[model samples]
Target: MNIQLRFFASVREKLGMSEQKAVLPPDIKTVGDVRLWLISRGDVWAEVLAPGRALRMACNQQMCEPDTLISEGAEIAFFPPVTGG
Candidate 1:
């Protein structure tokens, strides 16, 4: 499936790219699977998207959980939790 990936805040700074297009393998079915798939790329992908990290996700511009089902041409975004000082 073809999906769009977006990173924000420190996640973007850490990954060095704000957005990109991805072609996922058939095994990747959910937003969580997408994270694991990206981590498989190693290097920065692994660090920035490591398991156990506190991250927020969204699908198609709406906040979503990692278990959310994804589809072809979905837009997935990752970022830290919103905070205020």
Candidate 2:
């Protein structure tokens, strides 16, 4: 399946990328699966998307849980948790 990926805040800086158009493998079915597949790329991807990371996710611009199902051409975003002073 094909999907668009967006990175924000520290996640973008850490990954040195802001956006991507990805063609994912069939095994990647949910948002969490996407994260795990990205982590498999190693390096910064693994560190930023690893389990236990304080990250937030969105699907098609709506905040969603990791298990959220994804479809072809969906947009997925990952970012650090927001905070205000």
Please name the candidate that would achieve the greatest lDDT relative to the true structure: 2
Per-residue lDDT of candidate 1, residues 1-85 (tens digit): 9999999999999999999999999999999999999999999989989988899999999999889999999999999989999
True lDDT of residue 44, candidate 1:
91
Model 2 Cα lDDT, one tens digit per residue, 1-85? 9999999999999999999999999889999999999999999899999998999999999999999999999999999999999
Q: How accurate locally, in lDDT, is each candidate?
A: 0.95, 0.97
Superposed model 2: Cα runs more than 4 Å off: none
lDDT, residue 41, model 1: 93
